[model samples]
Target: MVWGLTPLFVHQRILPVECWYPFDEKRKYVYETLYFIQILAQGQIGQVFGNGSGVYVVLITLICGQYDILFCSLKNVLYTAEINSGVSAELLRGKQLAVDKEKEELNQYFVSKETFENLDNLDQRLVKRNLRNATKDALNECIRHHQGIVKVCTLLEEFYNPFCLVKSLQMTVQLCFLVFVSVNTTASVLKSLNLAQYLFMTLCELFIFTYLGQVLKVQSLKTADALFRCDWYLLDLDIRKNLLIFLPIAIRPVQMTSAKFSGMDTQRLRAILTQAFSFFTLLQSLT
Candidate 1:
């Protein structure tokens, strides 16, 4: 039952890694999780780690689901790092190119009428004129890269929106069940690693998704500052106006959520913990 439903809930990501980062697009992927329940769907259901019911039927899904979310979070963190490096590099490179072009332009126009005649020889003036003629370029690579980063964030929100919703629903039901088992079969539940493992896996899975989204949001906010530091004033007037488009995006910020319920972050994680305990308490009181 869990096997078939996993993929429907998973949705992977919208744009593959290649679409977001050049390095990721170029590098071949290996040892990556294809979906949430690959092993179980491969006829390993009754035989996860060569164990049966109290283990196989339960632990495999819990552990695999936990692992899937964790792996996704780790990849997201790495991807964000690549994005930061790319953004920084492109911003600096474009600024330097702008500076070089500015120097060449300065050669054509007098820095000041007094300073131009003070040059020792024509060769000094010639270098600036020749370099200006040579450095003729109009480009803003940073904007394109920022667009890519924004796309990644957009896709991430799309991919994980459904994921967090389904998982929240799944966890609510799963935790309620765990609370029941822990209440009614306290000794048996304590004795079995499988049962305890399920609880641990639930918390860990929730932590990874919420925390990763939170970090992504935090980093996305930093891009605004990165954009400001990119020497936009030095860019051509047209280019500077075009660069202003990023300002709105940065100010509003990028974020992911659990079905629009809340921002996925440490606060969300804390709320989940509180809800779990509250659920456990409500369950205990009823019993």
Candidate 2:
């Protein structure tokens, strides 16, 4: 709002935007009216940016939150399956301890009497079958969740990719001109401050998008890593086979892009700033 009224402090009549007008703007009443119009238009533009960017950030944040939840879900699926399948951890541990003890005792020409009782107490085959089925079911559920996330991403891409493309193009030009103008000329302190604020705002907006894009990409790719870090080796052969099939698909990273022309990441931000600098350098040389 303060930026929109910058003309008020200039001590001379001016409009927020300079453009060709059909009528004279220097007339006392005409100047006041046009000045009011320009300030109001600028204010409206500010409002759109404030509110629209909030919504944009929220949607992206929600998507990122979902990715986080999916990661936790994938990591815990096996443990959850074991719990749900009523697998007794105590019995498994007892059986393992018995087998180890028996091995040690046999080397000393002694067999422990408790080893036979421990081995007979556990229904190992039934436990294994139940765990396998539970794990398979859990994996299937996780796959469905993954599919849902993919669909949401597709929808987001379709709706926002074009907007991102336009925003990137607009900011590229705006940053280039802003840098050129700021460097090439002298201005009043207030004007310089205003330009700096505008430049900062533009950079901040771009940073948000690129940073979030990078975050989404990282979180999406980590899904596979999370799965791999789980106890897959202990899983049944059939369950491992299912995971082997799903691992490659999970390994593919999700990247947010601008109409498929460019990705929205730190690298993209670097490219944009580089392009803007090149323009600034060229304009400086020409002048």
Candidate 3:
């Protein structure tokens, strides 16, 4: 039952989908469908178990099942909200870039065509001053939009902390449960199955699934972080040039120190490296 529900929960929470319909309409459909399914499944499971005296157990199970569905729905809603917020940030960034580009193009057009060259000295100076003022105004507008993007990014980061904490806690609890079950199962089956073989198989399966989950979580977080970090404000020429020179050197020590502090746990270190490299590589590739 848990295994079946886990995938459904993850799918609902993590899968990105476009909702073209009205929000209330889509939400109503989701709520109705999930509730109906939950009712049907709980009835079937209880009937199959044939344990009528286990009314309290059945009620608890039903409640938990419904709670999980609700949790998944909430997660989906939050995910969509974050994406929409990030899209607003992207729009602001794009608008700022467009304004800057337009100003640059206008300045270049005037300069290359020598539109002010034929004018008297005073006239040329006046034209140049007007162009500068216009450029300044455009830059100010861009800055305003960029500030909006920054605020959205900060909010997204704050939102993600709670989500990541919840996911990590869920994973930890699941891991502990698996360990307890495996240990108890192995002990009970010692007479029928070889102890070494049973333990090895169980441990292998646990490690595989846990590692896969960690990988998925790391990838998702890295993608979201990269999206949030996508700001034109960091693309100043001086900063970009210096970042290239400093990044390799800066990242190496941080990676090494994190690994050492982690007691050389290769799995954990590899996960860290994956996230670090992903961010750095994204920054480098964005030019």
Candidate 4:
């Protein structure tokens, strides 16, 4: 029962179509890979991940390629949500500034025209600066009221932590096995080619995950910059302190991990590819 239902079960329960729908071609890896996977499923082919790739090269090629595309599709979509929300916050800040300027201009009519003209140039400059800062402070308060910082952070952490752990485990196993296959001189040409294809897919997936993780980190840190950009310097000490409450947390970067341990960044991805290639070279030399 489980064998017959594996494809449907994985699609409905594990990998939904909606996950990949939001991503563009740039974000979605290798559309042909997904197509091949579906073809393998429809043909009722034998398992690909089994030890006997030499006996089932066609099935293995389709299976590995398809699963690779499936896995990488959502790495960007998951974090894009947080990034968009942060951008919206920045836009709100700019709008608030514009509204405050209009209000100040409206209030200027109350000041007597003679009194405003009589002020010295230096005093006028200082008064203008004070008005601008005060307006910004009020606007920052409104921005803070609307921010969902806690909610965004919580959801990101909850989703990223466990997802990377499972991916790391699965990739680790695939990497080890691929290396083993590469070293086996007795392996058929078709077997070697299938292993190489799978290795390429694995590398692509790792690159996608780490790249998206880095993007997420950068986007989250930009929120901190947005917070600091506010006119906290001119507000009263008490009000300033409130504005600063979330600033420190915002400044701290958000990161996704590989297996709940090491950070998933481009640096790590480079190391992985380097090591995989180096090992492949060593095995070739031995052969």
By TM-score, the best candidate is 2
For model 3, how many clashes? 0
In terms of lDDT, the poorest run of 10 residues in model 2 is 108-117
Q: Give the Å shift of residue 253 in candidate 4.
A: 1.7
Provide TM-scores for the models. 0.49, 0.81, 0.25, 0.44
Off by over 4 Å in 2: 87-129
Clashing pairs in 3: none
Whole-model alpha-carbon lDDT for candidate 1: 0.49
Evaluated at residue 167, the lDDT of candidate 3 is 32
What tens digits encode model 4's per-residue C-alpha lDDT throughout 161-228?
Answer: 66666665666566755886676657545445656777877767676667766655565555555444
> What's the best-to-worst order under TM-score?
2, 1, 4, 3
Candidate 3 segments whose C-alpha is farther than 4 A from its true place: 1-129, 179-287
2 or 3: which has the higher lDDT?
Answer: 2
lDDT string for model 1 (88-127, tens) is 4444345435544344322221111112112233333332
> 107-172, model 2: which lDDT tens digit per residue?
211111222223343445444547667888888888888888878887887877887888788788
lDDT of 4 at 11: 55
lDDT of 4: 0.48
